[model samples]
Target: MSLKSIFAIPFAKLATKKVYKWANKPFQTQEKVFQKLIADAKQTAFGKDHDFENIKTYEDFKKRVKVSDYEGLKPYVDRIVLGEQDVLWPGKPLYFAKTSGTTSGAKYIPITKESMPTHIKAARNALLFYILEKKDASFVDGKMIFLQGNPVLEDKNGIQLGRLSGIVAHFVPNYLLKNRLPSWETNCIEDWDTKVNAIVDETIDENMTVISGIPSWVQMYFEKLIAKTGKPIAEIFPNFNFFVYGGVNFEPYKNKFESLIGKKIDYVELYPASEGFIAYQDSQTAPGMLLQLNSGIFYEFIPATEFYDENPTRISIKEVRLGVNYVIILNTNAGLWGYNIGDTVEFTSLQPYRIKVTGRIKHFISAFGEHVIGKEVEKALKDSIKDTAINISEFTVAPQVNPESGLPYHEWFIEFENEPENLDDFTQKVDDSMQAQNIYYQDLIAGKVLRTLVIRKVKKGGFHEYMKSIGKFGGQNKIPQLSDNRKIADVLQNFLIE
Candidate 1:
């Protein structure tokens, strides 16, 4: 082993021990973080506006500070953008992690100096935990590539602004600089297709061991590597063994990734966002990611069922239960207060506060009151193809409210790597699985209010084409798993199989 890998062994153990201290005392750790956030920000504009000085308990916090989305907090963020100090947090944010927003154009999320290290630390701890569990730090000696946005930043009101991944890119430790791939010039290329091509050229013959990125984008890179080398990724980079990914569910893409790699390798799932590094998979055998209880953020959860209620029930980590679907809320050192990041999660383990991202709060198909979620649909499809040779590249679901034919039904647009022999049988299997999981969907079908769902085959590379058409072909962009309307389905019609 190289000196780096040899040194990583003891460091991994030390880091993981610190993680367990907080993980074992989750409630206490979170309460401490809660107290600190309120105490530190009491003099800031948001803190004062929300009556933080008198907020001594979680009850006081809920009553004084209301749950808010980006729009509700944008007023304070607007002032901060003009270089106002102590508007949200104290002083000014070190940077603004810019991300695409649906209705608000680009969103500028603040990253304070106090909160910045949490991002870096959590990412490092994720790998360190893996090394501790698997007893393997050999990958550290080999080249590592994280397919991320360009590290270039633009100045906005004296604060640097860039994509969250790009901002994080700037903070990569000096020790790993030589091991990271796709040199600076290639990363700065504006177009994704050209960038991927450049990445392929740069790393084609390198001793790459770890490849990380969003799954769909990584698949593109894998395809290019296979095409150019006439070999699976395993053969192209014989040392390649670790895959790191975030942003979306990996179950649907697992089979495709295995096929591309031509072998099963270790995988790590992360739950990082612009707001904070929330969680990461600590063990390969664990059901979900270990929540960062001692991170510079305090957490709250509102039941998904009651999220739309005027007075939704919000609770702290002390009251959360396993298997309940909740919309996660955040109050952080970055100055966000009761902020809804739109993600829905379910607790898999309460002892250490482990959670799995189920879906987005707004990304669901409830047109017929079935309230079908991203997790449900992904599970349904997974169940249908289990123990089979079938492979799916990508998919999305939408309600077909007004069909030309008989009754309205859910439409699943799937891009397949390996199609089932009997399309009708496969469709029926998926429909049956959906019915088994959701009572409302089953009732609708039995009541004759809606017919069984239909699957529309998307042409090869169709999703890629659609993404390119919308100018979001790559770099941290993801297709919503389900939509209430046909906005995506309408555009997908052009790519459907004849």
Candidate 2:
């Protein structure tokens, strides 16, 4: 082992121990964070407007601040964009993470000096936790590549503005500088395809070990590597035994990824966002990511089923229950208060508060009063393909409310890397799994209100084409697992294999 790996092992142990200190007392850590956020921001514009000084409890906070989305917070953000100080946080934000918005064209999420370190530390600690648990730190000696957005930044009123991943690129620890792959010039290449090709050229001969990124985009990179060398990734980089991914669930891509890499490798899931780094997979044996209660953010939970209801019940982390889907809200040091980031999660373990991302608040199929979420569809597909040679490249589901024949149904658009031998049997297996998991869906199917889901074979590269057409082809963008409306389904029709 190299000198770096030798040092990393001990450091990983120390860091992980530090994490356990707070992880062991999740509620207390979160309470401290909550109090600090409220106290520190009380003099800021948002705090004053929300009567933060009078807020002494979670109930007081709920009464003072209304849960808000980006549109609701835009007025304050607009002031900050115009070079105003103390509009949201004290002074001005250190950076603005520019992200694609649903209704708003582009969203600029503030990253304050106080809140920025938590993002970097959380990512680092995730790997350290893995090393500590596995007693392996040798990957630290090999070249590590994180496939991400262009690191190029544009100045916005003296605060740098760029994609969250790009902003993160600037803060890679000095110790890892020698081991990090893809030169800065290559990372700055604006076109993703060109950049990925350049990355392949640069790392083809390196002793690469750790690879990290969204699974879908990494699959694209893996495909490019295989195409260029006529070898699976494992053959190309024998030391590549660790994968770190976030942004989307990895189950649907697992079989395809194994085929690409030619073996199963250790994987770590993260819950990082433009707003904050919320959680990370702390143990290989654990079911969910350990929520970052000690991070510079306070958490709130609103049950997903009641999210759209008027006067929805909002509670603190202490009140959250396992297995219940809740829309996560944030109150951060970066000056976001009662902010809804659109993600819904379920606590998988409550002892130390571990959560699994269930779905997005807006990404669900409820066209027929049956709220089928991303987790259900993903689980159903995952279960159906078990003990088979089937490999799925990508998939998405949408309601087919006005079908030409019989009853309405859910339409699943799937791109297969390896097609099942019997398509009809496979479809039945998936439908059966879906019905078993969701009582409402089963009820609708039993009542003959909806037929079994129809699977539309999408031509290879169809999802890629759809994303490209929509100007979100790569770098943190992903196809939603399910949608209530026909927006995505209507566009997908053009790519269906007839």
Candidate 3:
């Protein structure tokens, strides 16, 4: 198909009626989820909305319910599991997606049957769109390689709670679920040391097509895949069509993956959270596809620009303006209602409500008043080694004040396969990128006061193995991009420096 016909979009025109329906209907569904939360939140959340003294109507619920993070909602989740209809998604506990949250501590996120339909609808819509864009939906539908965490949800005790992704994995259409592809659990979960060894045996036989997962684990597997196959990745899986990833950005991973595969793996953005599977990339560059099931969420926005301290300028879904950087706030079924998802995003365009996820609200290095966001850190890393062919699999940034120097500088611990040429020069270039973006760091870099950032290289699968050791596998939670305090920082510090 020609670019004119294929890329043609009068999206506003195409989404005319549909767009109106989406904006308006979602608010109503949000209202239903809020009813239970509004009553339950009365005791715990203090103020349910951001600033409202008391929650009354749907609007009041939006006003009174403070935009909350995962930590804030734990009490309500406890109330919910005890048989309170705290948030009104459909069905029983079925199971909680076993997720070790960033701040909520180790916990189970409820996934209800009532709201699960939206997850299926949203995931399907994302897939349907990729097919429709190509005009041939079934062209590459032979086998799907889901690089997912197959963690069994365990209760407080050590027994296997059940596989989290297996909930949707088993529910997948039978015929399409092929025997050739490896089941996510077949030595996949980062469990015993034997699991990784088992994965090598099970996955080596089949040629894969589409691959999906977070970038950190995917790169880990690729290293193993390369070592096992001995041949280039393309030769191992010539049928590969796309690399669909959620939880972290894919811009940097593109070149390395393409180089490995000997072809460009089409990149697809996925927004899967412990709360629920949210948005996805409609086309590679269509700003991200909104989940078709927002009808079940009462969505709100908190401007990241306004997140000076903990307080943020909150706006309701209908009240949201375009081209604004805001943290995602949701009132969803299955317990969490009127909650701040702790993610930041901006609307690229409207009609279909297209948005760009800027970064997570809390996942930035703002400790030193520089206000460095995840997006900025990504840019800095990309520019640092512009000439070299090194791609970062996973990285975390922390604003550390050297006890002797007394100057706060950002410490970036990046995971790469091997060190690129001119490591010192590469670090300098990254400093240049940082100075250009963050003022405080810029001053330090220009004055030569910067503590000369440290870059440590780890063994190939170290990060992957680390995550598994903690019970955070492929299917569990978002990669820890930017941690808040020293608790996680200490854990990361032991492995980072020489």
Per model, state how many residue pairs clash: 0, 0, 15
Q: Give the TM-score of candidate 2.
A: 0.99
Model 3 spans > 4 angstroms off:
1-58, 84-91, 102-104, 138-141, 151-163, 184-193, 291-293, 308-311, 321-323, 403-408, 443-452, 465-479, 484-498
Q: In candidate 1, where is summed lDDT lowest over 10 consecutive residues?
A: 468-477
Candidate 3: deviation at residue 246, Å?
Answer: 0.3
For each candidate, the alpha-carbon lDDT, in order, equals 0.93, 0.93, 0.61
Please give the TM-score that candidate 1 achieves against the real structure: 0.99
Task: TM-score winner between 2 and 3, please give it.
Answer: 2
**lDDT string, candidate 2, 137-226, tens digits:** 889989999998889899999999999999999999999999998899999988788888999999999999999999988999999999
Model 3 TM-score on a 0 to 1 scale: 0.80
Kindly list the per-residue Cα lDDT of model 3 for residues 52-102, writing each as its tens digit: 236667656644555556677777566555655433333345567665555
Q: State how far residue 457 of model 1 sits from its true place (Å).
A: 0.7
